[model samples]
Target: MGAEQIRRWESGALAHAVTDPFGQGPLPWLRGSEHYVDATGQVVPWYAEPDRDRGARGPRTADDVHRQIKGFAASGAVAPGQAIDFHITVDPPQQFSVDIYRIGHYAGAGAFKIITSPRLAGIVQPAPLAADRTVSCHHWWLSWRLQVPSHWAVGAHVAVLTTADGYRSHIPFTVRDDRPADLLLVLPDITWQAYNLYPEDGRTGASFYHAWDDNGRLLGERDAAVTVSFDRPYAGAGLPLHVGHAYDFIRWAERYGYDIAYADARDLHAGRVDATRYRGLVFPGHDEYWSVPMRRTVESARDQGTSLVFLSANSLYWQVELGPSPSGVPDRLLSCRKRRGPGKASLWREIDRAEQQLLGIQYAGQVPEPHPLVVRNAEHWLWEATGAGEGDELTGLVAGEADRYFPRTALPEHRRRILLAHSPYRDGSGALRHQETSLYRAPSGALVFASGTFAWSPALDRPGHVDSRIQRATANLLDRICKRD
Candidate 1:
């Protein structure tokens, strides 16, 4: 059957299938069997049909050995009635099709198929242009152009690319709308590009974090790219390294029917979004890269009574500058020299604008292993219904990177501040380190929350990592933020 035909058949079958209250489908990991009511009061199923073949081989590193097919969206996001381009490359050039899916909590199917493209001829695009520590594919041929349907809802979307032989990959983007919502979820597209080691063929791939030497030895930060372009596909399966963190939050938040709008981080940096229009702004992933305008706008929003939510650790750490692509598309190139260049290319803290001053807590250190999240200030409104008490420990809730309050740094002068979690974990060297989840109320009565650990969002929806306490606590925070004075 044709791709579109198959999509129709599966969708029809799902609509008639007995509803699974738990939302667990045949592929429990990828498909959900439950249903939930949306903000519009319509019942939606959370059922994402699993791909027969995802083409993902194992751990995807900077060096992606299985490069059957890959692609990238010309823009990280597009609004309804706008058109976006997909630049794709296929090894052993063959025909392929693109299937679009909107990622959400569709009654437990993690995603809902929106449309599918007919078979289109595919070919290998030109190689990347490397210069001055930057690898760019600004010259790649456009594989497809999608004029977004005006009826599509604003949310996180992905285009799945499948070759004739079934080699598949994905390209994630956001469908944004101008209409205001109670909460705005900003995807960290800038950080996604910062860590994208495209063409991860070992010889020429370069991201802001790392690159490979001529002899194929992985080089660290000192030798990494100072500038990274968004014109190339992401390494491995074409998904951003920490994208799942944001997806987890989206699924969990949507399941609860939160009135959330979506935007790309680039939209914030380019002055395309009015942050003050929303009651809250959420950064749902490892949003490490920031431009001057992005920081200033968010800070201004907070001062204007717009709350802020950082769901992951290590946020707003590296200060960057977004420039135009070689083709002059605005905000397509990200540059952060990270102490190697002059001006705003260093850490925000080095520029005397410590992240803690805005986030309530700044990056502390990496957690080599999962540790318990010890509850503090459990009586606070943020922990209202979680049944958590002081000194209660949530196992495996603190891992990956973490943040903590620094006494010496200039901090935000909030009317009230509280540390929600104060857990201690050993570092790689076995030295003791503490991670603190924090919340503070600004003079404008806007609340700023920092999860202080990368695992917080994943705990909300990721299988085997879901923690009911975290989910309830997050709901409490958002509910309070969305409430008007």
Candidate 2:
């Protein structure tokens, strides 16, 4: 319901305690500071309630930045015995202790830590250059490598780097799981990094849609981040967006003892997954940016009978390219050329790959106000045992963002087509429209389900704000799908 409640539930998903949940300890650069920036103009101090000066930036001592730590890799995943890279900023070069803890339910103690890397030492250096200078891409030099112990269980790992004086910052990554399971959950790492407004300056600190110039004008197609890198810390959460949405889905799945593996979007782009090994592949939340290869792989898997679930809205919309990162890793540099032309790479619609054709629904625009989802086809198998009926309202299910069916678009072949929720929304042009949550069966016997809203996953946790109707609906589907697979 509330942010703190969602966080407590997530924190309990862990088994035991290691350290207090990672926080911004002693870091001086904060997003809500008073500062302003102008294109071709100087940086000045300015703070306004409306944040009228979008790119306004404040001053930071070089020493304050030196104490910050940033982990850089295309994905947080690293195999046991594998080493991950991270950077640190501290003035005059001092030795700091590096600790690695696996964040998971340890025997039900909730978010406990096991000392994977205990008391390791490294020299902290000056913070990396903010490469773009205008954007928040911090190209911190590689400070150290953390090798995972071969015996550690596969889960999310948080790297806590602390100076001798105890100043600290948390860097998070995942331990790769190559094992087969009935379901695989993908944390939208690429999308998260794309939206992260680290060093939250108004002008240069944005993803494709996050830019605002000093004049309070949104960045144009060309001015937006043409290329974004992963070599930086998230402005908050160590991950962008939430511990409650996708992360909560993870806790729910795990708490129930469902067999699941974790990976990021890059794994899909790189063809690292044997999708056939699992019954379903899940895109957890706010999964927007996609590469050509990522789409092809997911499409192929779905056509071959593997179930695909998108637990969030605004998915597979933008077509981006992952260029070479500075570290020579592919898919590190996210490029979105949101424009029209023969050579232009932008939205999926512009490239003629309309996501609706595969998803059976397209972006209808976003629902601004919190509203209820009107169930359109309650008899559908997904509604089994939920006691829902046609015309019944599912409160708080339509929120944050939403998508509606595109009539003119070609949809995949299906035996049973059902619209679960019919809710209203407005497009970027602010025209009144609606979003629909739909389900259909493919020719190959695959079942495709899209939650059609960003709020769906949080609803799964039944956070007091929403009822158990959503929770019951999700469990019914997950049980049937995993059992069949």
Candidate 3:
């Protein structure tokens, strides 16, 4: 927007505030992962990281501390079978017992218990929430270890630690496994923690995009936390991005009885999954942050015949590193500097390693409104049982941020790239743009498919938003990819 347009917007905002001081009037807002899809469709965009000179570095720590929870609670981020070295933080501290539960499919219906620890002893103290740390780091008065069961399913799990008085918080972890299978499903744990504004006070911590200053001014790139730990719980929706965008794919694939193994984003970074052993690797929703080792491992897997499927947009946009926490455990703190700074600056595209090279499409722009996912190549095998045809549109599928082919280079290098959907939409600014869904074969004969939209997986089961075509199309990809065909 031009200076004149920005001034007009500011004037309108001021006028609205004057008329409706309480903010009860109707107003629209732009939501989620939307950004510049420049005219050249640059693989690594100029705006991937905030411009170096754009924002000032705020004070390194908060002015005041948020010492809120005055009740009993326990929490930690330890893998299955590993000890949590749990902590109980409360004023005049209270004793509590811990009950661990595996969140996904269990014996009957919901979560199944893994372990129940003996009632632990503790005392509370004044632990100021650390701004740079992005957590209270409540010192454990009575440090106790709670171990997860080894036989439990390898997926998302939460240990709901509570006191007899009902004060509680859900500590989450992934029971990472190395078993080889037809498919390897990766959970985007790092991204969830990256965006979480746990305490929500803005003093202690916030995600990369929404950090605040002493005067409550929104800081840009400088606001990004260099180190974020997984010791605390996810606030509000409890993994909103994962649940809304990735969980459905797990349910759908499992319901259909596919042999799938699970790994956290950290597992990929650590080279835990022998990617070559699996026929396919599935990355569900909003996987924007990644490390260099992770990128190399996946690309190597792709070169060695492991089919790759990204059921989301904005795949591998930022480069990040996994470091240890106050505890010497790797992957405890996600480290990223989304700026042209001294450390490993996170935006991968800005460093010239464009995500388009991996996923075959670059994140184009955000389209706030719901629109059809129009079919371009109806006869493609991916559309096998979807009953979609040329010109047919899958209503309400093109979601917030979208991916499109740059059209300037051959991403797959050797095979014919199949463009499926050429759906168009009006961006948040009312500018015209489009999202593309595509599939192609790599030089190693490995297949690669991208949904080009973040909403693709969630649309599988969401009410009204659910589309059979989308589900069928996904099922088609899984069956073929898993078979290593």
Candidate 1: count of backbone clashes, pairs at least 3 residues apart or interchain: 14
Candidate 1 weakest lDDT stretch, 10 residues: 16-25
Clashes within 3 Å, all models in order:
14, 26, 2
Candidate 3: where are CA atoms >4 Å away? 1-81, 88-92, 95-99, 105-144, 215-222, 237-243, 340-345
List where candidate 1 sits over 4 angstroms from the true fold. Answer: 1-29, 32-66, 341-345
Give the alpha carbon lDDT tens digit for every residue of 415-460 in model 3. 7778899999888789889999989899898889989986787676
Residue-level lDDT tens digits of model 2 in 72-131: 443457777887777655443555665666544344322445664445445544433444
Cα displacement (Å) at residue 472, model 2: 1.6
User: Which 10 successive residues of model 3 have the least lDDT summed?
Assistant: 24-33
| Runs of candidate 2 exceeding 4 Å displacement | 1-69, 73-76, 91-110, 120-127, 130-141, 162-168, 201-204, 211-222, 340-342, 425-431, 462-466
Candidate 3: residue 394 lDDT (0-100): 84
- The alpha-carbon RMSD values of the candidates against the true structure, listed in the order shown, are 9.5, 10.6, 12.6
Q: Which of candidates 2 and 3 is the stronger one according to TM-score?
A: 2
